[model samples]
Structure formats: C-alpha cells, structure tokens
Target: MSDSSINLDELRQRIDQLDGDILRLISERAACAQKVAHVKLAHDKDAVFYRPEREAQVLRRIMSLNEGPLDSEEMARLFREIMSACLALEQPIKVAYLGPEGTFTQQAALKHFGESAISLPMAAIDEVFREVEAGAVNYGVVPVENSTEGVVNHTLDTFMDSSIHICGEVVLRIHHHLLISDTTRRDKISRIYSHPQSFGQCRKWLDAHYPHAERVPVSSNAEAAKLVKTEWHSAAIAGDMAAKLYGLERVADKIEDRPDNSTRFLIIGSHQVPMAGEDKTSIVVAMRNQPGALHDLLEPFHRHKIDLTRIETRPSRTGVWNYVFFIDFKGHVDEPRVAAVLDEVRLRASELRVLGSYPQGVL
Candidate 1:
C-alpha cells in the first residue's frame, strides 16, 4: 500500500476511536442529567427542569475554555446541543415562537433552545405570549428589535398588557435573500412579496434590480415565500429557513441593504432567571405628562452609572399625553447598585415595572 493511503487509513481509524469515546461520554452525561432530575423532583414536586442562568453560565464557560480550530461560538453551539439533549432526557421543554413554521423568530427559538425542544408556531406575537402565560408552553420567543428597522412596536405593546417575564435573549444575524420557486420565471418576474420590514431592508437592492416589480407587503417573510410557490411571476424576500421550508431557490443571496443587519429576540416565561455573572434588566416606566419627567426617570441610572442598552417610548394605554418608556440596562436587580437605581427611579416615576433581569445572550 502507498504511504499516503496508509497514513489516511490510520487517521480514519483514530477518528473512529475518538467518535466512540465521544459517544460514551455523551451517554454518561445523559445519565448524570437524569439523576439531577430525580434529585430535584425528590426535593420539590414542581421543580423547574430548565434554568436559563445555569445554561447561560455553562455555554459561556464552554466558550471561554475553548481553544481550537473551530471558533468559540461554533464550539459553544456544539455544547449547547449536547446540553439541550441531556436536558430533554431530564424533561422535554416546549417553546412557542411567532411563526407559521418558518420565520426568523422560529430560527431564534431553535438557536436558543436547540432542535431537541418542542417548538410551536403562533400566528402573532401576542399568541406567543399567551401560550407561555397559559402554561401551554414552557417558554416563548418573540422579536424585540431589528438592527435596521428599530423596535418591533407590536412586541413592545403586547408586553405592556402581559405579565410575562424575560428569561433570556438571542440575537440572529438576518440575511434576506431573493428567493423563487422552481416554476418562477426570473426574467419575467413582475411582482415581489415580503414583510414590510424586509422590503425596507432590501429596498436599495430591489430598486436597483427590479424597480418595476410590484412590492407586495405581507404579514411575514414566510408568508411571502409561500405565495411565491404558486406564482411564476413572483419572488419573495426572506431568510434561509423560509426558503428551505418552502423549497424555494435563492435567486440573490444576502440582498439586505446593510451587511450587518440583525434582530434581537426575547425568551419569555413565568419565572425570573437568576444572574449568570453578566446580565441585563428590562423595565417599563410610565411617567406623568410633565416637563423633565424623562429626565427624572433617567437621572438615577446615570447617577448609579448603570449602562443603558436601549430606551424606547410608547404611548401609554392610560391617560392622554402619557407615555411608557421601555428601558434596558446592564446588571441584575439583585445587585446593590441596580436595586438602588430602581428604588430611586420608582420614587420619580408614576409607575415602574421590572419586567425581568436575565442573563445576557451568550450565543
């Protein structure tokens, strides 16, 4: 046999041995996870099987300890799947996301919970909240903001009426592609379908290429992809999952105007997550319609040196001219400074609600 062939055969044999070791280790981890479930159940009848903070800490540690040809994120993702699978053996988790099956929110849900999770698709953001609130699902995933399009106001508005708490968050880099079905006539395409935000994201690209094509706004990019499956003269602007789900081909990839386009999704549940070293807190503040009300509300955070991540204003459902400010900031509420800041803000504001203090997104 050739030396190269012998070397390749030996490498293959080594890989086979490593695979066996990996499988055995994974099995042992699964058994350990099962034992953990038994212990928790023995201690408390209604013990929560999932811990967002714990999972976040594990993934973060995996990322920090990783030193490999594969990047930290890639390594962490592998560990995430393993953890997810082991957790399923302990107790399967059901999650709901804003969807009709194939949307960015669904992708975010899978990314956060892993494929082992049972994911249900709800037609609206509020429905996702309802499912989680009703105990029909363990958690829910909904879009909070887009890098290009700003906040999803519907999501924010839904939060104002709901009692759901944020457990964790996941950020997905969005890459919209111009996709078509097998029957689509690329040259003869006269109509395009997409969510309004998607059209806005790919506006420049569409204007430069298919200016005359009628831009039809739909409920979601998934719906747009579904529509293109039957229309030969139509194309859809959507992400990879939708295209793959609908069996559509990408005519133009990554057509979003900005290369750095991304969206942040929130994981909502009933329980408050514990701190995982790095954390973020979300609160809604309703200030009386008066001069310097905003200033009064923000002064405490400034004084405490708390890093504010985002601040969004929505018209309050209460009295006229009243507004509610959705604020996101660094630090968990359990911390002294953060608690003090909240106490000060509460004194200045007409109404304030700390939605949640959760671990910042690790992946």
Candidate 2:
C-alpha cells in the first residue's frame, strides 16, 4: 500500500522519524571526525591534511557501492562536503587559485574543499604558487594540461624551483558556450573573448561559424564573460557557470571542437598524503641524455612492477641543452616496491625531485 492508501498522519510521522534518524547519524559522523582529530593530535601528529588517494578511493568506492537514483558523483559530493566541514572544524585551511573571482580554478578549489574551506584568488599562476609557498594559502590549484592543447608550460616550469607537493589531481570536463550580452546589437559579433585554452579548443568552431569576429584572449573565461556583458559587439566563450554568473545569453552550447576535451588540474600543498589504495606519484628526474640513461631509469619500474601513467619531457632550467623527464605513476612512496623503485631511480639519475603523491580525484 502507498501513502495515499494509508493514514496520512502516520505516513508523515514515519518520514519525520526517518529524517530524525538521518540527522542523528550526521551528528554522529561529525563527532567521530572530531574524535579522530583529537586522537591524531594526542599522538603529536598532524590532524588536518589532504589525502587525495583517500578521497579518490572514497569516491570510487562510493561509486561502486551506489544503489540509488542519485548517481555516484552526487553521493560523492555530499560526503565530500561533510568531510570538508569536519576537517575545517579540526583546522580551517585556506586555498589560493588563479582568479579575480568566478574562475574555473575557483570551481576546482570548491571541488577540493567544498563550501567549508576558504579560497583566495590570485591574478596569476605564479602568484598562486607564491602564496602557497609563503604560507598565505595552505594550498593552490593550477591547470597542468589539457587533453586537446597539451601541457601548460608555465606550471611545469614553475615546479623546477618550488618545493610544493602535488597532493591531488582533478580532471574537469570542459564545455565551451558562446555567451552574449542581451544588449548586444546586430547578429554580427565584432569580437570574441575567452581564456586561451577555451579559444584554442573552440578554434575550429569559431573559424567556421564566425570567421570575421576578432578572437581576443583574456586571462580567464570568467573575465571574458564579464567583458561580453559590457561590450555590445562582443561574445564570450566560457563555461555554464560563467555564463550564468554574468547573466549572459548562451547563444550556443558545447561549442568546443571536441566533446571529450578536459583539463587536468593539480592540487599543490606542503605535505605528502598517505596511500589510500589508488594514488599517483609525480616526480621530476634528470638523467643523462645518453642512449641507455632513459632505459636504465625506466627498467627499475618494470622490475618493481609499477604502472607508469604519464611521462613528459621538459627542457631543464639548469641549461638549454639539458632536459628533465617528469613522470607520474600509480603507486605511493610508502609502498615498499614503490620506495625501492625510487631508490633505484635516485642512483641512476643525477637529480630527482619527488613532486609528492596523493589520492587521485575520481572526477
């Protein structure tokens, strides 16, 4: 029998009771987190820390175990916010990202900490790194690479000198939309604005649709969206969030050249997170550019049975003729095998920098 066939008052009472139980459980979970913080502090340990591997595993587990209409991402976000609040209660953390406000990095900051943590916006990527380095922000988010456009060289080059660790990684699905100010006159747009990545991703689409429009590069998509609202002859290629925030008209949706285009962002912090099953370790290795040097360094991983995920070469800042290979693999430094691989790599390379490892973001 359904609620309509039963006594309405009794059915309402049952739902109310269920809600009470849910509230009680939420309270219990929060209390337990506080206790965990207390226990860690008692042991003279750091209570507040970001564990990317743990987060990735948690979200993945939640997705695997999901049995409802809410979807895995929905459930993961709900729990993520709760964990963020609990950690903030233990100790509030401040994060800095490239922004004036309402930027994609800000969205990344929210993804990392939910609504509980505070976020500070810096004008440039270097500033984001500097703020984190200076202890002005506990963490920072910056785009490392795009699926379509390749690696962000600035971020890669910045790592050569900074001591920040890569605590997590978030892969964001990117969608570009053409937003126009309502006041825009004439169907012929004189200018288009967006972040360079957005512009590049949507290049073909724009070339075909609006060949004569002046494509202008801006610092961020949000800034581009803001600019469109003020310029009657201009349109912005930005995400849904930017379009909505600026109250611009979404003339076209998913206007990027490819649907699978995504950006990989890195979470930079000062501590190494413990392994939580699935994790990624990033490190920069400088080896002799000789025939067997690369082979020697990579052979140890195969010997140790480690799965290397990504390997990229960047010109070494020490000299124009030299280069460093940055690698990402699916294992934590704490694992004996992983540790052994690193030890072996250290002996083979002239210089090695562990970029730190953390749980991967499931998104």
Work out the TM-score per prediction. Answer: 0.98, 0.91
lDDT of 1 by residue, 172-220 (tens): 9999999999999989999999999999889899999999999999989
Clashing pairs in 2: 52-359, 53-359
Q: State the lDDT of candidate 2 residue by residue for 204-281, as single tens digits.
A: 999999999998999999999889877889999988778778898888899999899988899998777888788889
Specify the poorest-scoring 10-residue window by lDDT in model 1.
314-323
Q: Cα lDDT of all candidates, in order?
A: 0.94, 0.86
Alpha carbon deviation, residue 67, candidate 1 (Å): 0.8
Instruction: Kindly report which residue stretches of model 2 are placed more than 4 angstroms away from their true locations once superposed.
Output: 1-14, 38-57
